[model samples]
Target chain A: MSDDVAKFLDADIPDPTDFPADAPGLRQLDEALRCTMCRELFEAPVTVNCPHGHCFCSMCIRTALATKDECPLCRHAIREVHLRRNTAVEDAVRAWGLARTFVLQVLREKEEAKAATVASKYFSGKPKSKKRRRTPELSSDDEVVEVGERNVSHSLKGHTSSSSSGVVPCPICNKSVPMQNINNHIDQGCPSPKDADLDVLLSPSSKSKGKQKQEWSKLFQGGGAGSATTGSKKGKGKSRGADQDADPLPKIAYDTVTQKRLREILEELDLPTTGDRATMSARHSRWVNMFNANLDASPSQRKSVKQLMLELRRWEEAEEKKKTRAKLDAKDFDSGQYQKDNKTTFARLVEAAKPKAPKKSQSPHEGPPASSLSPSDGDSIAPPRRTEVVTIED
Target chain B: MFEAGPVSEADFFTWEALIMGPKDTPFEGGVFAARLTFPADYPLSPFKMKFDPPLFHPNVYADGTVCISILHTPGDDPTMYEAASERWSPVQSVEKVLLSVISMLAEPNLESGANIDCCKLYRDNKAEYERIVREGIKAQLGL
Candidate 1:
């Protein structure tokens, strides 16, 4: 195999085997996070309304449903309309994605620590007595580990020594500001205040805390208002949240529609209209499926229209390449080899055709009738000169 | 019971495979060769599998093509006896199909036999069927 193909095949997929045998929960966690259809981490996961509430990546289920209406897991009847955004599972996946590397790091560290203890015990002569005496010290060692954990967290949060010191660094513009004023400084897009020292002395922390509370309450009030409106307008239009005003696209009955109408649909979606009728229908149908599935995702996780178009273009290009490759393969076909391979089938067909003469006049004898009609049938079968011309054209 | 991969690195749609005949059956200890032809939109459509130098079994056609419910899609039911649940779905993979084929070799579903001659021979003269199958295996192995 070529190095590139070998490397492509060697790409790592996170599986239960990545964890040590002792940690069973981590393995299950990894498995649970994967979509059953694609066997990859769920992307925009959505839950079906079945009794089991099976969750799958929105795109995966949508594609599967496009083929068959039943659920891939339990084989229960399901519809695209019953799919709901599974925000809880989505949040869990997001949190797991962030913590996976750190969890792996900690597990490796613990393994190394255990190995170091084992080596120390092996090297020392009085292992039992030393272990007994060091029990009390181990408690203090845990305290030191706790402190080490805090340091690691501080470093991860980019705070470093800022927790002990009053000055906090502005994350965006990278300037030191008072701890109390950091939020306001960030709220103002990290602009240098005209009188920073004066402002810190004048504005007490209490006022800033009250302002943060007001912002939180305002956010809740907005959410409540949005929910009330959505509740009232639920059946009229299934639009949810502020940004998701685009309703899910209904499936098109491609058979009933004319090619012109299909082109109009493509044009309506701002998609390219250059392909043939079949290609256009395939492109539009796939786009509708993707667009409808995108509506099932939480608004934050939804892909933009441009990204969907790009995906559609990529799919169309792949399909085009496959079609051309199929044509080339047909051109490369060795008819002689094919006939040789299927010789029995050809012989059987010839045998069936030959028996037609026997059917016309049979004294319950096959050979005599065939022999009697051979001259006329021979003349009738002598049209190969036309087939020779067709072969040249091919 | 079987291992399969692309016939060549450049073409993933065509695969070459080797299946060891299931134990405790007439076909036992015989290694069979097969080819799998996958559609461009696979997992949505089922692949085609045919044993090379066709096995002498009721479920295999004279031309070596396999006749199994799982390899047929839900819509393309020529036999009309297979249930929708037993037919191909996107969830069914090549591994599942191979495993099903192994069981099929052990216990052929004679109700929907692809080779009538084999099915009749199997039902009427059991010893003759086994002798034919064993001889075919020996000939395949050049033993």
Candidate 2:
């Protein structure tokens, strides 16, 4: 069931390694890479010429420009057009995204190796020669090649060698035994081990690998993912035999296109066409982003258009709801401006509410009697008057 | 992490920061320590910045609380002095606030003086005001 959903939804390849997301080094890297404005990984990063040298994603700066012309960091006057795209930062973010997976894999392997060593020490009755040879080799390689190709190759060699000895490591207990006896070892020999480890080692990879191979074959037939899918679908289902790649879809001239035609085009693409022209345009842009983002994903995880459309619709609804809520909240309260403008009326209400002050003091001839009152009395009376006014206004 | 100021957190909600006064200002060469108390709904509401051993500045009240437009709520201004855009917004972080405070020290807004006496002195006798401010900085430093 999930396989079908995965086909339509751009699924991220779940990291095969056991690296924790919150590992301190990874967290620090995440923070460093995050845009100052959106607090997310930089997308089309741009640096503003502020004194403080703050950088924000392009979208964030555009949004900030709508309200304030000043830099968010230093309040120095900055125009959106003046923002220079930080190619260096953009490259850094791209490199980090690709490197993150490899780094996590290496770290998880190192951690597992350490755990295996500790377990070997605890279970000392096992053949000491195998343990001694493996420990020094693993530790030396770990220290020498902490983050390069050498470490991965070394680990791969270690796995092959252990397998060659008619012994496959019981993944659960990290114990080496014959491949034929591995299942029996796990069932009877190893103490109650984490079931998750077994599942991780066994299931998802085999299923995902098959799906990946199918995707690769599809890619080769189609030429490019985007053009191929659109061409095949648009060819009235008869051009399946055409070995040549189709031309890319013509860009829709939204301004020139009639609303009816636009809606029809959207319908053809299996996209939602329920909203107004602006919303439709927004939906279309979001669809393009989803489509392009899916194409950018590893071949195995590329999503179908139908799934991308569904995602776009969900996102649009969420954004619409958030905007409506903010509008309602802003409209509900005037933030004490009303009280400040109507101070006299509030003072009168306060005087009226007070336990019938002497008529002589409250007389119209007293000429704004608040000034005549003692400073202490005036201070005591002012706050309640403002609060009372606010309540009445509400 | 600041070079001009070192910030130490008492907790997530409370922080103490020592700011070195900006160069070529009356406040230059002084290390002013202030406490920033973040409300539970911080970023939504601005943090309260209070200088320890209050500095006599037009924007700082006698009680040591610094009054700046950036520290005001991102709502309709009751005083009508600051635009809503100039007031606090969630996008404004703690680093921005500290930089703003330092800038505020260099260029005091005498129009809305929280310290009335300092405002009057600053307006009437610029030299005397500078001398007095220098003395205040010296006293804080025990010079």
Candidate 3:
């Protein structure tokens, strides 16, 4: 195989470029809804309580604050407590989420229609001059029809019911099929009209929406149980009663906490206390950040405790690997220089170890070996010679 | 413009970069080959960058590690010379590091010199220092 590295980009992810070049306004609109830190469309977006009032994904801001108690964009002094739900932005994001796939499909159709029109004009035996003049008028009309209110209402109608000639994504396969043909398409096991782009755009979103609803309902139940603790616990005690409240977890003073106390805390959270004191403290702090961040998210968007725990474990594993790699690198970096720096200590250690072997043998049988050393100085010039029977013969 | 990507598809932790030396400096016209090794906890912790063949500059160590305040973490002020505000934070990225290093090449920070010989030559004999740097680049290019 060629030595050239594989070039890849996350081209599938919805980005500002999803809007065509002509729609710079729409592109900017798409960009405005994204979190700067994660560079993804905002999920559970929160406005930083600063003069700048910058918005970020709830998890993004919480993770940033955990590292440094300031805004990532403006460096304004901030804390997790300062974050407030930006419901206006949330609604905007939600509306955009539903509109995004529809817009993309419509845009794609419009482009195809333009291209087909252009091709027919070029290839057909029509007068070139006459065709050129008519093409502009035709294009302008198409733009007004496709991009204006008429197309949106038509698509919405098709989305709800497959009666009109307007296109709707097939429920089973998610391809943009003509509204009238959706039932036939599914009846034939979604065989044809293989529009992969629309499928890719629409299917994931529908799936995520379902998953999100399930998680929201689960969280809602847990929250309800938490509120009615006395009654709910009697029915089902599975609810994560510890973290259902709205209050943020108090920050742990990692430096002051004993290892035993930290391990106990980890155990209470059902977390692995496998790493050292420092690791345990770091893990606990990270868990707190994640837990509090989940609380910040809208109840419908909050992840389950099990999901959060899995994320924590994954993060810790990655971090632990990095730490071990760094340690190994430090040991391997300029080995000769490292040896030189510790040469004296190494020499002292060797010297300390030399006398211990002789003392171990002599201590079991010989009493007051120090006193015997002066009397046997005539033959005790070498310590090994004095312990010859044990050293070699024995 | 500087360009960088992973050296191999299997290993994202290490990246190879081609940085154009800042214009109007001794290092101008030199296309430096540098390696960026990112820790697993990247963006949270800054990556380590080094010139492969090593650059002869005061702020660059003989081993080619860049000695700039922006690359150093807040907890890593061994010399106690850099201010906390100037040090690396989560907000810093590879692009910022690249820009800082380019500026560093244009004007070396003598306060925290990495190469004592280069620093001394730069301070005591500016003409000789630039001449040596140019000659070194010429030798590297086999010109």
State which candidate has the highest lDDT: 1
What's the lDDT for residue A293 in model 3? Answer: 72
Tens digits of per-residue lDDT, candidate 3, B31-120, equal 677888876555556778999778899999999888889887676887889977788766566777787888999999999999999999
Question: What does TM-score give for chain A of every model?
Answer: 0.54, 0.38, 0.57
Model 2 chain A poorest ten-residue lDDT run: A377-386
Q: Which candidate is the best by DockQ?
A: 1
Interface RMSDs of the predictions, in order, are 22.2, 21.7, 31.6
- TM-scores for every candidate against the unseen true structure: 0.64, 0.36, 0.63
- Mind giving the per-residue lDDT tens digits that candidate 1 earns over A1-394? 2554455447443554577868869988978987876666677789887778999888878888888888877778898889988889877876676456557756666555555554554566454445555575575366455655654555556543445458755543346887777667655534433434423323344243444233323322343454454454432222223326777777788899999998777655545566678877888888887887777655655655534544565465567656766765675778898899999999999989985765455433211122222222111111111112112222
Instruction: Give the Cα-based TM-score of candidate 2 against the true structure.
Output: 0.36
lDDT per prediction?
Answer: 0.66, 0.57, 0.65
lDDT of 2 by residue, B13-112 (tens): 4566566677898888776667776553344457788987678899999978999998987444677888756788646776777778889999999877
lDDT of 1 by residue, B35-135 (tens): 88876566667889998767889999998999999998777877678887888876667777888998999998888999999999999998999999998
For candidate 1, give the docking quality class from DockQ. Answer: acceptable
